[model samples]
Target chain A: MESNQNENKLYILFFLVLSVILLFLSSQMSWLRNYISYVYTNTSHDQVVNGRQVKNYFTLFSEIIEIKNENEKLRDENSTLKSQLDTISFLIEENTQLKKSERFLAKKSKYSEVNMFMGEGLEIGYIDLGSDNGVKKGGVVQYGQYYVGFIDSLDRSSGTVKLPYNRSSFIQVSVIKPTNIEGLNTDQLKRLVSEKTKSKAVAIGKGDWVSVENISTDKGVADGDFVITNDPKIGSYLVLGRIKDLDRDPASSSITSSIEISVNYYDLNRYIIEIQ
Target chain B: MSEVIITIFGIFLMPILSPFFYGFLGINVTALFSLLVLRYSHNLWVYITIFILSLLNDVTFHLLFGSTFISIYVSYIFDIIIKRVIPNETRTLDLIFTTISFFLFYVSLEIFMNLSSGSGFRAFENFQELASSLLYSFIMSSVLLLISMFRTYFSGGTGHKIIKL
Candidate 1:
């Protein structure tokens, strides 16, 4: 009788121990909880293993079918976007050549050729191409026809091109209009025009931007006037943006104003960088 | 000479063996293999041996230090608890308890690291993976238990009896 009672006691202890273990495991292992949840939700379920949770085996097959259908839909959308981008790039290159010929006919100075090399990834993207390559600091960088940024740091093999849209980039520019004005000396106007051509400016923010400061407003600057870098080294005018804001200080002897300039970094794949 | 040879072999072999590589087969199976291969006589000695082994495992593999220590300690706790409750330990109990204990140990460690680092840890991400790991450990531990039983049976004569408690 005592041995039988002890056997019964041992069985009870075994059950208690197993229950405690399962409780502990369920709390700790998310998989165990998921299995329990799956089992509880599927009332007719019997066994739950790692790979196959068989709820009468029929339902498991249905779940696999649904997942395969979703996968096919994502792949089709990915291919469509890639084709559209390819067509857009081809048109932009053709248009830039036409504009280049128009500028040459107008007797405007030619844009400088800026070579750009794509890097592996962002982490080590700043590796320079080579020492022999003419890439230098303060040289402008562009993606396609639109201005991207400038070379901030360079090594023997690579350089870090600081994007104009990057929070840190800033440059000085001047606004120019279509009609030439009187009383502005030809040399002084030329100097101002040259300076406005490829000069540097700091990036304050990004959006559809216009107008920039540190340029004289008394030169008959208006809302639609074109601003470009004022650096004399880069002789050609790179269209920045249009003036959206103009605040003239009337009391000051020297005219000081703020003008918005235009350059959309996102619209182009390549940039026209000016070597300084 | 045998003891020295075993000790030297353990020292040479441990760093080369990795839980990650073994965990591909299953975390539990790898863990059970580690426990069986590194088994010692005394409880204190077992804990210390496992701790050192785990540390060596961590350093060689470039894993987070003390991870193996946490795993081993949790297993040791479960071993003690099972030994106390089931005086005559069955193979099934051993398998179930070790699997549960190992699972809990990994889950707790992951949770603690995630909370402390403020990022979610990805040790065993899915339910299927966890289930496989548990099964692997159970099977491996059972194999080890069977081997141990066989060794005992062969080593003793007909007059010798197996200890129940």
Candidate 2:
């Protein structure tokens, strides 16, 4: 028995040493982790591992069908609107109002599911697409034309997206006067963003939403105005969100407002984006 | 049957569960489960199971490899020390030892992963985050352990009596 105990100790020691070596090796071998992650991703299937219950939205088949119908209706409406706007060939100079920006064309794109969210405010999210998919850092992530986030970091097969609401996210944006975009169709708004805008304010991420500050009162910035990313690279084609919580203080020279990210992109299963 | 349950939840389910634990919940349920196993069994397979779980954990979360594995071993070392000093026979002693082991586990994990981080590593650089995470997990796991122990006590024995096999 004493001999067996010693033998057991040696076996444990050997196993531990082997594990430590393998651990070091795993860091160097990225594909190993990627392969394993793929296995886990398939198994978890959007299960909330947070130990907290996530409400199942599709408990009933009717709910799923209803959502599908709503989606179909939106797609149809979008197509009609596109056709209605196609007659007016867009005339605005696309670069007139933009800051001197990164001038790369987004020739490639991909779709990814959000793996999970992390960080202090739970604003940082990891998506399944990674460097492997030609996803570069600073890649703009969008849901169609609406700006959502930027790629913060990446592993072999996954990338972290810094949501616009993350404290670390600050995007340069121009506040479009409410009148500029009020009745304009998607194409018209896209054109309007390219022209010189009334107010240029820095959108500072403020947890669940962003706050655009330092806009002069004369700029006619209102609660319903459009906030679009005015970055030097990747011009203002994508809408950041819309202005809300319009704070106008008489004592202050500038006005501040919160930009409401209209859609809860978090609820979307897949993120499809054209990244430059 | 209990071994089967532990094998399923402790090894298979933990990799799926750990990211949620480590991400915002600030706990390592894998470590918690491993602690329970170590608290009861010195079987070689227990260590191997934890090692596999940690590996799967790092893979799933895209964390630094072996970070979780090494951290658990560090906790195991603490457990060994405490096992000697504290008679873990009573319920209170058991809880006390487990808590201390968990605290050391997180500390080791934080320090180990961050040090191995090519960036500078000061063990205490992010002390507040670590403490808050520890507090959160500790309270939660303590409640869980307490409930299990109570239920088992009523069932005529300990929650996990040392299985000699």
Candidate 3:
């Protein structure tokens, strides 16, 4: 009984202290945390379960389960592909407008002249065109007319572009209300256009949401109005996202109310990084 | 050997089940882990294994480093205190201990995040989510523990009936 009196207390104290130190060090150096995550994921690729390797489970029942999961995955892929096809067709027209301008396209005749690089999210990407193909850092990456991202770092074979949804993305924006008004009076149309076009707002991306911190509370901005980038490089109006909702703080009679807009980054499959 | 098995089991199973409990508030597997550690393991390495399990969870969930481990450690300490205070094994005590353990873990995590990132409005929103998740976790953990007890009883262990408080 004396021998069995929990000697584990010493072990617990040691580990607890070690963990606290590691935590403090990791908080100061985020890269260390990232390195730990990288190591963990790589090491646990073939984890064991019930005395058997997880990857080695190839029984008939397991196969059926695998097939079911694969089916669901395929269904998701199908929907994503369908949406990409729709976006591609929409981009084709925009490409045509770009080609007409001698300055925008330069020597390139078609939009497809610039190679496409598909990215998983705002962070990592694989560009088909790299440094060898005139792809350089500090370049504008556009998906058709809309400036989606900019090339940050590049490799000899490929480049990485930071997309709009990333926290670092900042874009100057203006609102436009697109409608079917083929026969509206000139005076009414001009007045409507003037009212809709207000002071430019800076939109900062926060993951899936983009927030406009300064928009007039009384501005006749409504849901479904298209937000466009005010970048001068691309002379044409490019759509960013639609205004989703707005909230005002009642306590402070501030002139501007914060607006939250939704921008779906899912359907983007292709991008054109303008060489610096 | 059993310790190793439980460690592996916790590491693999917790991440899979976490998402089901995590929506409004993040319901982690740390509370369940501490409870299991208390029930089955006698070695000090068992706690270390649980801590490592939480670190693995942080990596898998893309959370800040040391967040899960710190929260789980706080919960583990809470478990130790409850165990020391009331060593009796009863359904009421188990439920109370589990509730307190989970609550402490969540509060510790919230404090860490708030202090680390100065997450002001986000912290308030997260607290609301935490409240909802706390109820979900308490019900789930208690029911699962009771089920395990019943299973043990049916398998021919010396069974104790639930007593009125």
Candidate 4:
């Protein structure tokens, strides 16, 4: 019995030593680590890992058909709006004087539209762009005029966009408190924040919704304010969501007293990745 | 065969549940695997499996090298000793041991990570985050233990051998 106990101890010692060696080797070897991550991501079907339902090809095909119909309707509306906009461009440009500004004239970032929805989670989707297309790891993704997601991971052929609703997705954002106007236009709001005080806060993803945290209650952040990304790489004050409510009291004496706000994003299919 | 299946299941399940316990920083659910191995598997295979799973977790989550591996291995050894001392491991004993071992795993791993991180390690800044994460983890572990106890009672003590064999 004593001999058996001694052997067990020896076995444990050997395993422990082996594990330490493996750990050291793994840390040093980037290829080994990358391969493991690649395999894990590949094997991990989207919605399955995130507890979202996996849709069959038939359901997907039907959804595609529905989207196609909606696209045509939007296309007709866009064309009609474009003709009307052309007639009023001179008047609008004269009023805002934004057309003269280089910042206003230049596009903030290049976009890669949604190619496919990959994986189990609705938030984790795939785009057609790759490293060759300059799609980077931290590149911001957008849906229409709103900030939605960022590039989670990517390879040579494809990339993953972690939507605003993902649990680990954290983005720095600043709330827009309209001072002089009831509802300011995007251009006006951008110029205002850029010219004046732009205090940034962090927003964390929570599945279907988002929550802004670490915001000092003393910042005078109120309800119905708009949240926009502070990512310089994106270089645009694209609205992310509206602040539905506040968590902390502005009257609280505690220095650690911080407020949280709810965030909502557009549906997954409308997302576009900003590539450089 | 059964052990391999269970270990694989655990590796897949732990990461999914971990983000829920996450506070300012992520909660250390790799400790849960260590706890599971301690409670079950009298042999060395479970420990070995846990080591591999912990390695996979560290790599996937971009944790520091040997941080989680060493912390969990130490916790496994700690649990072994605790099991011996508290021979009749009741629900209360299980909760107590889990809190002790979980905190042990967290502190040891965090220290190791901080040490490895060099200038990036902010001890005072991270203290609140770690504390909040620890509290959340404790609550989650308590709920899990309660569920296990309930399952054992409902199954007519068949599940009671979770700590023994």
Candidate 5:
């Protein structure tokens, strides 16, 4: 009985010590983990494993059915977390766009939403605004700050908006990769982008989209560069569209690029503005 | 030559084979290696060498650092307890203790691994698998232990020692 008691006491002490150490190690103590890793450089080849670049040989060789099932469960959980993260990122992006739209609205107080009657050839839009409503002949019809087209002709109560894709439309534009000149503000960047026509080209109508013409191959302009309106009559420094693709002609020493406008007409752009 | 082979197998091939055995046969060669090594060897360097081997095995197994190290510690501690508790050297007790030490080593290792993998107290959730693995480990270690004895007798070692009381 006395010997049995000693054995039980030893068992208790052993369990107590083991439990404490196990718990201590199990805790996510970064400092302790880092210390152990520093002492032992071969903590893991975790980069390759975690990056999913290589097969984790241990998992391949020794993972039992139960462990595989657990991994599947964790993968499902990871997918759910990834979707939740995407939702949050989308909300953040929408919030940023909303803020930018708000600033855009504040800057242009002379914006009016009008109905667009599509021309017979689907080339131009006849708007319900005219000179009587402060509508001018040369001002742009825009969606927020995105250049859609300009007022070609205006009468007592209506006007014609020449769409970017209209065959008769021709406008001078500048193209530049969006970059922040560290110390410059948006106004300063706007002045610089409006004045520097390094990517000077004419946007000509192509019935479906606008194509850049006469751009020199040495202009340093690439696809996806922002196309800004340089025609001061239509309002200077307004973003027209992004350069979709650039096709260079070696003989002519010129490049051709198509612009991908943000707004899709006849869908979400029924209501637009004549922003001066 | 045989001794060198067994050492190499236990130190090197056993780690790789252990995974194959565990995945299919459910035999724990790692536990078996610990039992045989501690049972036979007394050299400090031998223990240190096995400890290093255990470290390599942990990396190969992708287990948390020091998992196989703790398994070695389990065997060492059990050896101490048995030597201290038993008053006489009995082969039966030696076999029983070795098996028991293997059980403890696996238990500690599984618990540590499960905890590290975010399983928490659900370590033994696959109770049936764990039980069978322990059984296979016991059988393998016991068979190897008996084979080593037979080898000892054939080689004219201490296995054939006899005396009239």
Candidate 6:
């Protein structure tokens, strides 16, 4: 009975000792935590495997169904193509006539010998095709029929084209009125332009938007009047935004009108830089 | 001749295999296999093997340098802890310990890499990627343990005798 009691005590002591060691080892060895994470991950992976197999089976079945639908679509397309083949020669003749008319119209207009590679956005990197490619610094870059920006710096292979949307960029623009308005004098217009320059108009804050400031109500500058860059070297009148707001300057009694300029980056994305 | 060939193979193959397996299936099979191998042969040779295999893994995988170094070293620390603490050397206990060790190794590696790269604690931001990594580590370690058991059974030897705590 005494030996049995001693054995029981020894077993309890052994358990306590083992527990202490395990706790100490776990505290010191940081990898034990990682091992727990590993097990957890393994169990999760197994769960996912089971889940994904079911999902994949359904996805594959759906894909087969889609293929059948696509096959029917192709059959319809094939029959339509066959039907169109008879009219192909007649369409080709008409297409050639259209091409001739387009060419005639293109020949009559002035075409600039410039090519541009547009960037994805305002922050995109610029590459210059160089002066050898008729690209130079200070050259204007135009998107489909509107001025976007100009070349700021040039390299042998590429140039840095600065977008007009940059805050630092400033260009002189001409404010032209419709031919129907003849009563507005040039002095009145000059005063209007001067007042516009002085007023703190939000419209002219960035290159993306500009405002023509302080025109008199009598000068008759309508919403549709073209405001264009005054650079004769550019050789083309670019359409700036329509006048959105007309307001008189309260601080200046002489300032009577303001025209807000709109510049859209979307329209400017297609422009090629014209090398100066 | 065989020993020399195996040593060279381990040196060259571990790194290439680690990332390839990790990337393809999210498991570092080679690292786990190396750990199991090292379990039997706890000596200078084993440490050397671990170091070389880890170096190979680091170089071939384009992972940050010193990552494998730190991971294997930490794994060695865990091996010591397991040996010192677990008196019974039961397979279940070994598995549990190894899993925990593997997780800690991954966490340490991320911390070490972040410190070395100076990236601001961005590791946890990609929880899915981290989860996949942990899953791969567990799979690799489990397979390695199973293979070690199979190896012992087939050889009619207990493999490396577990050192008593």
| Top-DockQ structure, candidate number | 2
Q: Give DockQ: model 1.
A: 0.02
User: lDDT by residue for model 6 over A1-276, one digit each (tens)?
Assistant: 787557645643454344345433533544644553453445434444655565677689889999999999999999899879846754565455334323222233332334345565552226547766767677666533345567777777777666544555555555565322123232443444444322221223254344555444445555665454444455444434445555555565433233343445432222344443
Q: Tell me the TM-score of each prediction against the true structure.
A: 0.33, 0.43, 0.40, 0.40, 0.37, 0.35
* DockQ of structure 5: 0.04
Leading candidate by TM-score: 2
lDDT per residue for candidate 2 within A119-185, as digits (tens), equals 4564787777777767778777765456778888888678888888888888888877655333343
Give lDDT: candidate 3, residue A26: 56
In candidate 3, which residue pairs get closer than 3 Å at backbone N, Cα or C atoms, i.e. clash? none
Model 5 interface CAPRI class: incorrect
Deviating ranges (above 4 Å) for candidate 2: A1-4, A42-45, A48-276, B20-24, B88-90, B140-144, B147-155, B158-165
lDDT of 4 by residue, A119-186 (tens): 67546878777898888898776544456567888998788878776888777777767445224454
Clashing pairs in model 4, backbone N/Cα/C closer than 3 A: A46-A119, A46-A120, A46-A121, A47-A119, A47-A120, A47-A121, A48-A120
- The sequence of per-residue lDDT tens digits that candidate 5 reaches over residues A1-276 is 787557645643564355456446635545544564554434233422342322344456556876889999999999999999987886676456434544454354566667677776547888888888888887677655567778888897998988888998888888877653334433655776856556788888989778998787887888778787777566545677878888876787788889887666664434446544
Per-residue lDDT tens digits for candidate 5, residues B10-109, read 6656545555555544565666666566556544444444655565555455456567767667766886788889947466766677667777777777
Model 4, stretches more than 4 Å misplaced?
Answer: A1-11, A41-276, B1-4, B11-26, B86-90, B120-124, B154-165
Clashes of each: 40, 3, 0, 7, 0, 20
Error of 1 at A129 (Å): 3.9
- Candidates ranked by lDDT: 2, 5, 4, 3, 6, 1
Q: Write the per-residue lDDT of candidate 1 for residues B20-78, one digit (tens) a residue.
A: 33433334333554456434332333333344455444333333445555555556567
Give model 2's TM-score for chain A to 2 decimal places.
Answer: 0.54
How would the docking of model 4 be graded? incorrect
Estimate the TM-score for candidate 2: 0.43
Candidate 1 per-residue lDDT, tens place, A130-183, comes to: 344656666655433233456678776657776433445455555566433223
Better of 3 and 6 by TM-score: 3
DockQ of 3: 0.09
